[model samples]
Target: MQERIPRRTLLAGLGAGLVLPAAARAGDLAAAGWASARGGEGGRTLRVTTLAPDGPGSFRAAVEAAGPRKVVFDVVGVIDLGRKSIRIREPFLTVAGETAPSPGITFIRGGIQVESHDVVLRHLRVRAGRDGAPDRSGWEVDGITCWKAHDVIVDHCSIAWATDENLSASGPRFDGGDTVEAWRQGTSRRITFSNNIVSEGLSHASHVKGEHSKGTLIHDNATEVLIVGNLYAHNLERNQLFKGAVHAVSVNNLVYDPGTRAMHYALNAPEWEGRAWQVGQLALVGNVIKGGASTRPDLPFLIVEGQGDLDLYARDNRAAYADGRPMPELRVLPTTPLPKVRRLARPPLWPKGLKALPASAVEASVLATAGARPWDRDAIDLRVLRQVKDGTGRVIDDEKEVGGYPK
Candidate 1:
């Protein structure tokens, strides 16, 4: 249990920019990893009074309001987005979906896009389905994507049915300044995607690029990313892919039913045609990957592709088939082989207080704590978790296969 600190003292320390201790971090479950230090500490409260996609008291309205604020919900159930996303451009904001009623709040037909800094999002569910759009109609939506955003934490949310990557950190690969470090800083950095349930991304849906049932894409140049304690299920590929120049740590995640691919790294040559190549640095520790019905046979834990190089550190990552048979740890594409995918003796970067659970314990821990309102899970989330346990889910083309949206 978390010991309570006085509101006065907490605010005072926040104002003083004091790094919170582990006990203090426990007070707010959303505070963890690289993003644990700062967020909307002294913000005004903004209440979401309706489930409408947009209006005076809608979720969209509260997020778009000026200044630092913590958005709380007065209503629950789904917010039909009319197949359009809500863009959050303000800095120092907290969207506290856990403050809602028992069922909590859910967004359908669209998702949230974070384009600012110092943001904390928790306990929300974004079901960004195709919304009856024709296949290849270019209606790509992500279940909470951060673009060039920093000091952000997205925790315990349920994301599914996305046409594109479910939860991604993406931006201009090279921007801001002259040096490589400056370019990395210009994009999304210091972001945490933790304890979330990312599942059932729509395969052969409304994406313009054809089949794109992806999990999470840490885009090129994004840095200081921490992905821990999340459940990735029934996604076709990109079960969290790290592009070139990305520095990320993925630990203790439970991945199930990832078809053809589990975790991957790639750096497109055309995307960096004229510029110098940047190597991706990644550390995968204590993660559990179990193949399901949709998964192909003899798939390794990771597949590296594209033209750029990668420095990787993998430890205690367990991969198994549905029948409990072991699988390989790493496989590079034949096109990009050998030294292009270098194995690192030590981790490239490690967060200050990240405690990765053992691979054997990842499944139980994530199933119990991941996703929105785990104590009061929605029907869809419950079904997904059950299928994960039974090794019985598939990559679907539509949400209707899983009974569509919740009431």
Candidate 2:
């Protein structure tokens, strides 16, 4: 029973104020061969090796026969539901579920549910249905839901076991009284979860407590956002009650042995009304934080308790703290020194009466040497003059000779 039009009659049968040419804009190539010939008859564009034979309902009847617009799913391998069990039911839309309300794929129990929108699930490998669980209906419900999806891309996939957590959505479920019921709804914008490899569900593992899972970019989703090079060796109370609010950008990831004793970052907003923890721009760069001695003496690679203006940045890291304690004050910044004089707008190619030296004679030969300062402008790697500094060092004269010029 799915045929309810009238979103202005599906934008007037998609000819709503039309305009095409300039090679049919929208990622050109004649608008992707007119969206792969409206997605059928050797459908011109939906590669993943041109998947057919009815699955994802022949990719939702090849995106409603590619008529509407914007289709690009270049997933090169693994669309094997060999042990068949792929379900996506519900009002579904796609474009990443309408700008990103979360769910390129999801399935939460109770008579199974699924949704879609502006979809783009790349390099696919969606598993989770080896036939296990259903005494009261749980594991074995292959999921994928997306609402309000826009510009969504779950790239380079390998989404595993998934009793849960490849993509999530939340809001609603406090029924003691009052009027509210939102066990994860929508709102996702410009979403892009690149280089994926999500894992979970050894035996019914997909537990996500809610608070409207925030905007994410979760770069390199290490084992499904376990954080840093993914390493979860055994369920230590669901990896210490895994939480989320994530305004993410977490880089290089490698959260290895975090069974407990470490890993805690909370800012509870008492069910969203008090609404605290709002991390805007965070960029933890080049990570490699090793086990902090079983982790929980007071874990904090980062922990903000809400307010706003949270613009953090951590560079070239390599932390360690498994009870050998001594790594706090995680507010580092001081490693700037590398210039000495190297600015060439144009001038290079030796021997022809070579004479190209003046930036005030390389700043008076680096202020006459000796721990050269004067804001040591960096860039001078003149092979440290072949290191032969004996006669109490200090020599550059020859009229401040710089590129081949000492006759």
Q: Which candidate leads in lDDT?
A: 1
lDDT of 2 by residue, 313-355 (tens): 4455444555445445242222222111222232211112212
Query: How well is each residue in 33-124 modelled by candidate 1, as lDDT tens digits?
Result: 67642556798899999888888999999889888898889998889998879999988888887789878888999899999988889889
Residue 350's lDDT within candidate 2 is 15
Scored against the true structure, residue 6 in model 1 reaches a CA lDDT of 40
**Model 1 alpha-carbon drift over 4 Å, by segment:** 1-27, 336-339
Model 2 poorest 10 in a row by lDDT = 27-36
C-alpha local distance difference test of each model: 0.84, 0.28
